[model samples]
Target chain A: MTLGRLNHVGVATPSIEKSIPIYRDLLGATKIHEAFDLPAQGVRVCFVDTPNSQIELIEPLGETSPILKFLEKNPLGGQHHVCFEVPDIHAAKAEMEAKGAKVLGEPRIGAHGTPVIFVHPKDMGGVLVELMEAPKREH
Target chain B: MTLGRLNHVGVATPSIEKSIPIYRDLLGATKIHEAFDLPAQGVRVCFVDTPNSQIELIEPLGETSPILKFLEKNPLGGQHHVCFEVPDIHAAKAEMEAKGAKVLGEPRIGAHGTPVIFVHPKDMGGVLVELMEAPKREH
Candidate 1:
């Protein structure tokens, strides 16, 4: 239940390439990180850095990708979930479970290379919530 | 379309009273400000301050409230929209217009008593985005 920061907002896009101009030209956003394909997650992702947090643009990797299903419903894509940082993944998972929340699965490595898990939207006020362990601070 | 900072994530709830326990007991969230009503907006809102930003719990104030439509589709409530701060509302509006983004209406006073406007979601990757004029720093 302890949260550190809002790392990013997961945005589902039909095509990350096509969506770039909207954020760049219309929003005046620069410094977009290179897009990457995360096979384990069945999606391609690009991080658009904002001053305080990031907008994670995600695209389906294949026809069978879950993101494809989401896109089928929305067509144009939409907000998928919000990711927040927690100091400890295991503890956060346990805390959420203790309060009767439904965690989708065990903690798995996410796009940021940090352990992450998603809480079911039904148990989270109809909003799919992602909790990720913050990258360890370099001393 | 320049942005200042993330002000808060707007969450639509059927009842803020029922939703409080979820955030407070489950999410370990504290520092919930007193709930207030915005007659013009026709919604009651409460700001739950988080480590970095805030979660805005909004409930329709009356049958004519606009939030009613959102709640009708999502009875249990859900993440509504995300708000970002803008240094200058007028300039940001012009910038978004220059690139063909649809601004919902003229600048109006938002919950925080600052000028704000909503960008049509169709142009924003299916996300309803709010742009608020940032509060000037006290020198």
Candidate 2:
């Protein structure tokens, strides 16, 4: 299974509003998409376009948000996960399991509307990794 | 200062040797570079090339390594910092300072042999960001 791409770096922030300027003003990112809430994922997300990949800014959406614990520890936000695109999600999952890497949960539709799954940090050398199914090209 | 690329995502690990297989076997990364020690920075480093960017795996090289405290906090290792390339390192440093972001230190030759500076995490919305000067083009 060849890794498709370094899709994006997930950053958990307390406030996407507070984070935008750093990417736009400081990093000179010209194409930052509007922030939106992903209720299913329990986070609000915005994509900051870079020449090659993107910076995914994620903010907690509800009190029970998954990232709340992370924010509680960090208090100021930080890198949460790094996503890599894969051609096939199920194959990737099977390979991971076969290799003794634990998948956090079944693949679900991610922020980009593509199937994605998270690998446990312990299995991923302490960094949470998200394997996202690559979007199909229009014929 | 337009961001040139999402140069690499830095992952702090206890051992780069242990980290290489996850990238090569699990992620199917074919271009795993040789791990080498950077004595000046007190870390051993390796590059896992993705199609668009790279994942920099860094391990503490000595007892005085800068990432020692981080490793102490996160025993399993974790995402450390994200590096972005800029056309001019000096201009990027000045702009960050003007925006009230504290530059970690004077721009110094970084892992890639280009001048780079780190912006304080507090100023970058709780994320540590490295600004690297784009490599000069060979004419």
Candidate 3:
């Protein structure tokens, strides 16, 4: 259960459209991906690719979206959770729990279409950490 | 000024010592570096290496440390900033200002001893972004 590559850093944003130029023009990021909605996750997500790892821009999709609370606290949005790849999702979850870290919920399919589980921020140095099974191929 | 590698994600902590175990034992991170103080930045920093990038654990070095204000707002501490490498610091700064992004201050030597500048989070999709001159050789 060694630490793996950082998959991406999730950033909760109020508007993905407005945020695109910041990455594209300001940062000279040319590989900006299109924004899409994940109804089950209750968020619209976009990926801005860096040479290594990515920045995931997420916006609320519905009234009950979890990002709504974070937005309430930070009207302008902010850095959300960081996702890391793991060899096995179930093994990672068991290791986390055994180490006395709180797993947010049972392993479930994440936006990357792989099983993932989130570890509680309070138990993970105040950083919400998402552990996802490594994708079968480059995404 | 094209986007380079995702260098590291900075995590502010009240105590770097307390945060080490979280990355080490809990996440099975083996390449945790020794902590050191950067009096100029007023933060004690440590690096935890992952396959792709690194996680920087920062603890306030003194009462006047800038991180103190952030810690006051987020008592448990949290993700502070994300650093990206650039081929040229001056070019990146000019490009950002030209794009209407507010660069926090003139480029200065950062903890990594490289010229770096920070963009205002308000203008960066609510993410504090640090742009550093790519190191001459990997640290």
iRMS values in order, in angstroms? 1.6, 0.9, 0.8
Best by DockQ: 2
Kindly indicate the candidate among 1 and 3 with the higher DockQ.
3
Estimate the overall C-alpha local distance difference test score of candidate 1.
0.85
Runs of candidate 3 with Cα error greater than 4 angstroms are: none
lDDT tens readout by residue for model 3, A1-139: 8999999999999999988888887888879987888887899999999999999999999999989999999888899999999999999998899988899879988888899999999997779899999998856
Give one digit per residue, the lDDT tens place, for model 2 in B10-129: 999999999898899988999988888888888999999999999999999889999999999998899999999998889888888987889998998888889999999988878889
Query: In every candidate, how many clashes are there?
Result: 0, 0, 0
- The local lDDT score (0 to 100) that residue A31 gets in candidate 2 is 95
Task: Give the DockQ-based CAPRI class for model 3.
Answer: high
Model 2 chain B: weakest 10-residue lDDT segment is B32-41
For candidate 2, lDDT tens digit of each residue in A1-139? Answer: 8877999999999899988988888888999998998999999999999999999999999899999999999888999999999998999999999989999989999988999999999988899999999998699
Q: What are the per-residue Cα lDDT tens digits for candidate 1 across A1-139?
A: 5546778888899999988887787776767899999888899999987788888999999767878887987787788888888889999999999889999989999999999999998887877888999998699
Model 1: residue A78 alpha-carbon error in angstroms: 1.3
Candidate 1 regions exceeding 4 Å error are none
On the 0 to 100 scale, the lDDT of residue A63 in model 1 is 69
- Please list, in the order the candidates appear, how each scores on TM-score for chain B only: 0.94, 0.95, 0.95
Model 2 chain A scores worst on lDDT over the 10 consecutive residues at A19-28
| DockQ list for all candidates | 0.64, 0.87, 0.85
Worst 10 contiguous positions by lDDT, candidate 3 chain B:
B130-139
